[model samples]
Each structure stands twice: as structure tokens, then as C-alpha cells.
Target chain A: AQSVAQPEDQVNVAEGNPLTVKCTYSVSGNPYLFWYVQYPNRGLQFLLKYITGDNLVKGSYGFEAEFNKSQTSFHLKKPSALVSDSALYFCAAEPRTGANNLFFGTGTRLTVIP
Target chain B: SAVISQKPSRDICQRGTSLTIQCQVDSQVTMMFWYRQQPGQSLTLIATANQGSEATYESGFVIDKFPISRPNLTFSTLTVSNMSPEDSSIYLCSGAGGPSYEQYFGPGTRLTVT
Candidate 1:
């Protein structure tokens, strides 16, 4: 089984401060990790993915994530937060073997306060 | 990356009625997946659809309740039967390209059963 966990239900950050949304995973084999953002009444937009290469992966909208194999974590990060970056963030993982369907976390709501 | 579109972006239906959501991909894809996201929650995989084969559903989801069709490589449909308030959720369709397991998603169908 492949599963991801997002401990925080919501995160609040000041407009110019750095922000981090935590994610952890458990999988049968190697994991393919992904981050997606969903705005109000819209579909999910892909952010970034960690497959096999560098642990640090940069994504759109000045967002990035660091994949730590030992910690079994892939935490999304932003150098500086913006009010427009507020949205729902989801972390998903797929096992290298077996099924290709992704298992997603419960999601984290990010609020950037101006 | 493949572009996916879903029809009837949002709908309100009466209880016991059924609604079928269609997903179309710009290019051919080998696998299509359906997912559901409840209000303020994460996503759950409903089923996996492949052309020329019966859809594979995840646990707690039955084929009778959520019938799926993958008649071709570029299109699929998911029908929600005997709709109830509990079934009110945003349904999303995603497609995976050739060798890359990265999945791209549609805008999602917001189904509200009243």
C-alpha cells in the first residue's frame, strides 16, 4: 500500500515569510511523489514531482519541495509567501510497482495573510 | 503533458437520479483514473479505467454504484448512480501518459445531490 499523510489541516503565514506544508508517506517500494494545488472551484494544477533524481524539486508559482528518503517526507516549501498563493495543497504518492493510482493525503489549506 | 477536460463542470441533481461525467483527453492515454474529493478533504481514487476492459474499482467503491466506461484511448465516462447527499463531491478524472506515471487532471465535475 502507498499512502501519504499531511499532518496540518491548515497553515497560516505572513506575506513575505517562508512557508512549509509537511507531508509524509509510506509505500511498498520506491515512491513517486507529487504536489498539486487547487484553487476555489477549479481543478488541480500540478506543482512538482519527485521520482528518482534530486531530492529538491522546484515547481510553479515559486513553490518547491524537498524529498527526504530517510524521513519518508516530501514537504512543500516557498521562499516567500504571497496572498495569491493561498489555496488547497495535496500530496500524493504512487508505489513504483503494482498499481499506478495515486494515494493522496487529507490536504492542507494554506492561508497567506497580508 | 496531456490536456484533459470534463463536461458539466458543476451540477445539482435530485436524490436517486444519476449523472454521468465525461472526460476527454487531447491525446491518447493508456490509463484513466477517477477520483472523488469531499468538501474540505483530500482525494480518493474511485476507479481505474482502461480501454477495452472493465474498470478496476478501489475498496469501498462498487461498480454498480459508480459505473465507468473507457470506450477509447482518449475518452472515458463515470456515472454516479442512485445519487444521495453522501455522494455530493467533486469528481476528477486524470490521465497518465506513456512511460511517465505523472498524471494530469481535468477541471473536475462538482456534483451536488439534494
Candidate 2:
């Protein structure tokens, strides 16, 4: 089974400060990890993904994630947070071999305070 | 990147009725998926809608309860049957396309079963 975990339910960060939303995964095979953001009343917007790539992956809206194999983690990061960055973040994972259905973690709500 | 759209951005429905949510993608996609996110919960894969075949449902989700249809590569629908308050959720549709084959999601349909 492929699953991801977001340890934090909510994360608060000051504007212009770096923000990190933690995510970890468990999969039977190589993992395809993804990060998505959802604003209130809207659908999810893809942030970035890590397949077979470099350890650090950059994504939309000035966001990036580090894929740490040893730690089994793919934590989302932003160099500078904005108040508009407040949203729900989800981490998803799937096995590279079969069943591409993504198993998502309980979301982490990020609130960037001004 | 693939652009996806869903109809009935938000709806309030009575219990015991069924609502079919439609998903349309800008480009042809081999795989489309349906997911449900209950209040404050992570997204759960309902089924995989592949063109020209019956949808493959996930565990705890049955075709009878959540019927799916994929008429073509760019279109699919998911019908929630016998609605209840427990079924009140945000339903999302996503498709895999482009060179990376990464998934892109549609604006979710917020279904409120009253």
C-alpha cells in the first residue's frame, strides 16, 4: 500500500519567512510523490512532483519540495511566505509499478500571517 | 499540462437523491480519477475512470454506490447514489496528461447533502 502522512494539521508562518509543511510516505516500490494546494471553495492546484529526479524539486507559485529518500519525506517549502499563500496543502504518493491511484495524506492547512 | 473543468461547482441536495458530477479535460487523457474529501479529511480515491472500460473502484467504494463513466478520453462522470449527510463532501476529478504524465485536477464540486 502506498500512503503519505502530513504530521501537521496547521502551520503558521510570518510573511516573508520560509515555510515548511512536512510530508512523509510509505510505499512498496519507488514512490511518485506530489504536492497540491487548495484554496477555499476551489479545486486542488498541482504544486510539484518528484518522480526520478533531483532531490530538490521546484514547483508553481514559488514553492518547492525536497525529496529525502533516507528520511522517507517530501516536505513542501517556500523561500518567502505571503499572506495569499494561506491554503490547504496535500501530499500524495503512488507506487511506480502498478495502480497509479494516488493515496493522499490528511491535509495541512497553511496560514501565512502578515 | 492538462486543463480540467467540472460542472456544478457547488450544490445543495436533499438526502436520497443522486448527483452526477461531470469532468472534462482539455486534452485526451488515458487515465482519469475521482476523489472525495470529507470535512477536514484527506482526499480518498473513489475510482479510476479509463476510457473504453468499466471504472476500477478502490476499497470501501463500490460501483453501485458511486457509478462512474468514461465515454471518451477527455470526459468522465461520477454519480453519487443514495446521498446522505455522510456523503456531503468536495468531489474532485483529475487526469494524467502531457509529457510528464502528472495529474491535474479540476475545480472541485462541493456537494452538500441536506
Each candidate's fnat, listed in order, reads 0.62, 0.64
Top lDDT hit: 1
True lDDT of residue A40, candidate 2 = 85
CAPRI accuracy category, model 1: medium
Best by DockQ: 1
DockQ for each numbered candidate = 0.65, 0.60
User: lDDT of all the models against the reference?
Assistant: 0.92, 0.90
Q: What is the TM-score of chain A alone in each candidate?
A: 0.96, 0.96
Query: In model 1, which regions exceed 4 Å deviation?
Result: B98-100
**Residue pairs in collision within model 1:** none
How many angstroms is residue A2 displaced in model 2 relative to the true structure, after the best TM-score fit?
3.1
Q: Candidate 2: lDDT of B77?
A: 95
lDDT of 2 by residue, B1-114 (tens): 789999989899999999999999998987899999888888999999978889998899999999999999999999999999999999999998532356889989999999
**Model 1: share of real contacts kept:** 0.62
